[model samples]
Target: MSLKQESPDESLKSQIYTFCRQIANSRPIISVCLCDGSMRAFFGGTKALLEFLLIIKGFKPRLMNYVRFFDDRPAIFYAVDRWVFEKDVDVGFLGEAFAVHLIFPYTPLVNAGYLRAKEVKLKKRLILELLENLVLTFPELSREIRIKPEYFVYESMLNRARLFPPMYNTLSHFFQNEVCEQNFNRVMEGYLIALKELEKEGLVECENGFYKISKSFIENFKSRKTLFTNLFRSAQKALFMSLLGAFPKVLGVLSERADILLKFQFFEKG
Candidate 1:
């Protein structure tokens, strides 16, 4: 069944319940994935499942609470056995429902700037946790996803922007770094050009003077690939050129490091 933003009706709940029970009885690993902003069943080997579990290690109890108690909140809930997933404990939802909660922000914090200082501080903490989970889950699967370097830069800008104090006076701070600080105008010019390119591509948009990532970007991120796969080869090339032209030295060093890492992986396999 296709998952959507609609509230869970009684029939949908029953189907999910049955599906969970059947899978728990037979499968050794059960995972739920958010796809196109909806929850659906996901299957993976033991290692992938374990890696995903590590990313979400601490959020299980809260997620189980969300599942056990029905709320008017528009969410899809699924139940799976903790014993089946973890092998030792007969406890919670085995991190099933939490994936939905953690991955998708129910409401995008677009006006984060308007929030009070204390409120912004609290939001930053939560955003950081979400960011950590997201980073941990993706690196191992990045190869399979074929995430291009330019998209990585685009995603980094959005994430880094989220970490900044929303009240900061200028968006240029989003591009600030040791490299940018040293070659300020050059790096800033390149990043701004790249940012505008990303905006043109619709992966990000300017909202309240902040860059708000698109739902399509989030979906691609959730899947660990597949955002602009068939669509943006030319745009991706343009983005790479923008970065390469702006930071040739830095990109050169990065390329060398990547080559070394790739060689090491090959050595291990060989």
Candidate 2:
């Protein structure tokens, strides 16, 4: 469709409806990921996101920028426009504690935006530590799976970056099937869709394949860092700047701490 302004609330709902028509058309078992929490896990891979990530990976000519964040609870609503979620493969590592939010283009939730919700909980910090340690200490996950931790940390540092893959595709990698590109499309598609809407609203613009975070998300984020405003929001503003400041230091500290693991692995492998 054409672009339009997107409100955070609307973006949230449209993302949920994505899977209704696309995923429901698939096998009934695939639809089960809708049980809750399942949708959240799947968000890790989508092409809309890869557009920029392709940059972190050294892909050039990309202009749009996006941010990736995972809170304690994460959910993803899959939309295919054609393919429906059909099955849930057996999986371990993450255990039965997880699920997916599957849908088909026909699912009413596509129009309504909540076919299902997946219950997924992950401490984002813990994940950063885990991936940092793994890349630092061990051999890469596999030759096919790039082990240069820096390139792929934005979305998944571990788990389906494959400490845990989707329950459906968890074991597929062992046999050599690849979903990296397809999954990338699925995850990014939602944002791309949202971007389209946001552009129509004139909140932001895109050139080539990249998108600009509507000034709204950025302006709101910047308010916390504003040193001088009405002077009334100092406390509020400080909180955001403090957080912005901490983000870099925290990442640097972890990288330095984890670099020790990298050094040891490097010499040993050499």
Candidate 3:
């Protein structure tokens, strides 16, 4: 199948679905060659690759029903029916089945680009704060985990935006000081000190200079749904207040336009 098919009005979702369908029809374990111009043309650039992943994540429930993504590096590998496959199978028929199943009957109200931006800025910040709070509040877990400051930033970048993983240089460049000098190391040192406390609790582990959050740790936290819900609500309220306080113009505009407030209420209710 030629990958050069063009659709001027094609949305990102359609592009991703097409790419995945092509891979599913190929070998059981297909490697998408990003170095080739075809994949780049489909995705636009390396940054758009990240955007593609984020967009796919938004459709996780639907996609997970048929196929599952293994990893993004080297190339994206997926299995048709199983999460892991030992050998290749004839999946040409399955690809057609997926094409029929994955059809979008109507155009999406929000495009992938806007969704990605919103998620990176708001959803990612909330998640990072929650993770930090989790580590700090649980002393036992803290003692077990040892994480570098960079991990939080990298994880946040991955979670919020599709930006590449934070490397030494990227971190340094992004977090420059007032004098235009990088002080990421110093900031990272502070994070490491906090993470070290968690490391003592035997909950955290460092593998090849990267701190890893264990599955059990996440499960444990997830089990405490009530606590997390309360914490999340409090955080949301605090964030809203902070934003309002920071932008007096926004507050003034909202006050002057009561209809806008009512519209927001209607949106929240819906």
Candidate 4:
């Protein structure tokens, strides 16, 4: 049973169970992703972002009623959980999905003239998660996947274009310390290779300096998440991890779009 878009609660729970059952019967777990889009679909709006998050985090559900993001992109948050993957998480349905949500190799923000802010990280994690899923599902690419660690660095930097303008320095200052000239250039080279690999797999369409993920990738990602595993964790849990570390708004998707539930956003649209 292939998975479809966010559906009614009945369809969501049924499909989720089916996917989980399959993973349980398979080999080592591969990938686990979270999306902001799925969160909106499940909870219905960003108004509940904080409320639902609190509930999931053992907070008083009613007390969280005041939290809200109210951004764009269906304000949906979604993600999937995989046990062990060989390489990438190319759910095809990359952005707006949780799989590509938490992993921001660099700062993530969507500003004027820069639509794709998290492209680099998105590509890297998407491929890694997808490869992981495929490896667990197909058992091939296991060795090849490991050989291309550079693939992630390259893919994660491709979307840096969205770093300027309205977002300006606000975004760069956050990640500037993490990336220097040497390391940044290395990541750029990796981005090129990763883009090449993605194009070969029909995941994205690329021009001279710009790139875009194919709709098929999005659809496949949704299907894999729907038909394969259950989403137990969320961006909220991952980011706002008070027990572990401080959770800052490094990834703008969570801030720009409020409907996203982070990790727990993959429930059939309720």
Candidate 5:
């Protein structure tokens, strides 16, 4: 029997998937390594690794410096402790290591360069706001609001760039942020998870295969004097910087509004 050659992204995904499955099976795995040039980091614990993989799956990291898997062993720990504390606790056989090396095509739409913990949370909050506004503004059909998950993800990343160009640009690290057909399923699934989160927050309701804004959410939104209160609270600096940078005219307008500065606590000493 022979195995077929897999692309760099696929190879990386397979290795991580195997490592995750091993962890699930109670293997003695310590961590998964993500390497880029001279920089590298370990993603430990099941939940964190899974989330990391989710980002990789959607982004399709183009130039993988290579992924290395390491398993736990008493000998490695003993050597480390002896070097640091001048004492040893245990010594056993060495652990196993697996490495996958590959280089992907140039000009990949998404890559590991954009994958950051802070950016992930930022993107999530922005997407939630986008969906909320969509449901609220889009005309209802037959007196029932319905939003397709697939369409939302598609438009949010590409078609709707004009509506939130700064946000989409910031969410994407590269110059190109278009969604490829291959990665759309995972991306859509990721957004579906976001939709579920909105539903859990009582902001949206799901019924008959679509989503609509919850009545309470509508009432609250109507009562509010500003629409971005929650959005600003969740992402204060990033959103402000992006918006201000995109539109310098906004700065001139904002500078004249002393009340706005005080309201946002920009005048308060930190």
Candidate 6:
């Protein structure tokens, strides 16, 4: 059945099964010993990692939680067992195998900012960066069209803005290193000011908290394709740099599983 015809639970199950089957078919397996506790930990860690990855890909937190509980755990275990039985590898090795084969490769596309993640911090810099990237990637955003700040903010938050203080709180919690209440307010203020500055520069028109891009900017941007290309390249550079900073921490986490460490080394070489 098509995804639209299925219940959310069924759809989730299908997605998990598909992912497992792909892994089962593709990755070469290796043997490794694991105690029951270690196996459980690997599964738990993999689940958490997937949840984080999904969150970064703009999935709703509530939906991810539901899928994790009802579908992901079972599917993951099934994949591990299938790999173990088929390849004569210990079950422990499959977690790292799945992560290296599936998760790492998928991350870059998600990090590309094509779909804004839910719970993504709507800091002024990120919003501006996104706008800059959007203008670079899609000429349409540069056109003269009215857009409400509220609408922009809502979309920037990936439609999760409706959760209000709670949503803000969640973001604060997750991004504790980068965001706090004071910083959040400051960033918001700066975002508003940036809009005002764009209005002042005649790049946009702001009236009564609503704004519209200027026709002149659109015409200018159209002529300056090279500038847009540079902006796009810069956005990509920034994304990779951001990921690099977090890579060590992620590597440390995966290193706990020797099989994952070896798989990661193999993937890195290729």
Full-model lDDT for every candidate: 0.31, 0.28, 0.34, 0.34, 0.34, 0.35
For every model shown, the clashing-pair count is: 0, 54, 15, 59, 0, 0
Candidate 2 local distance difference test against the native: 0.28
Tell me the spans in candidate 6 whose CA falls farther than 4 Å from its real position. 1-144, 150-184, 226-235, 247-270
* Highest-TM-score candidate: 5
lDDT by residue (1-270, candidate 5, tens digit) is 111222334554565556434332432222232321111112222211111221122112211111122231000000011111111001101100001000101111124343222223333454555555654465243125666766665554452234334434323422233433333443444456666777888877888778776777666655655456534432543443344233322322343344442242211121
Superior candidate under lDDT, 2 versus 5: 5
Residue-wise C-alpha lDDT for candidate 2, range 1-270, written one tens digit per residue = 211222324453454334232233332212222221122223333221110001011112111111222221222222221111111112111121221122111122222232222111122222222333333344233111232222222333233323222322322321233444444343334434444555676544565554333445344434454334323332432343243323322332333244332332211111
Per-model RMSD to reference = 22.2, 21.8, 22.4, 18.7, 18.8, 18.6
The digit string of per-residue lDDT tens for model 3 on 212-239 reads: 6665566666566456654564454444
Give the Cα-based TM-score of candidate 5 against the true structure.
Answer: 0.36
Per-residue lDDT of 1-270 in model 6, one digit per residue for the tens?
Answer: 111111224554455444433333443322111111122223334432232222111212211111122222321121233222222112112212222111111212123342112112223333444454456667765564456664444354432223222233223332355323333342244356556666677776776666766777667655654675554544543443243223433443554454463443311111
lDDT, candidate 4, 114-205, per-residue tens: 21323453455445454444445544333232223444443333322132122222235224553344334533543566677777778666
Off by over 4 Å in 1: 1-182, 225-270
Clashing pairs in 6: none
Ranking by TM-score: 5, 6, 3, 4, 2, 1
How do the predictions measure up, each by TM-score? Answer: 0.21, 0.26, 0.28, 0.27, 0.36, 0.33
Tell me the lDDT of candidate 1: 0.31
Q: Please provide, for model 1 over 124-238, each residue's C-alpha lDDT reduced to its tens digit, 9 standing for 90 to 100.
A: 3333233334434664542234322233334533443333322121234223463233333322333345555666776656555455555565556667543354225224423
Candidate 6 residue 230 Cα shift, in angstroms, is 5.7
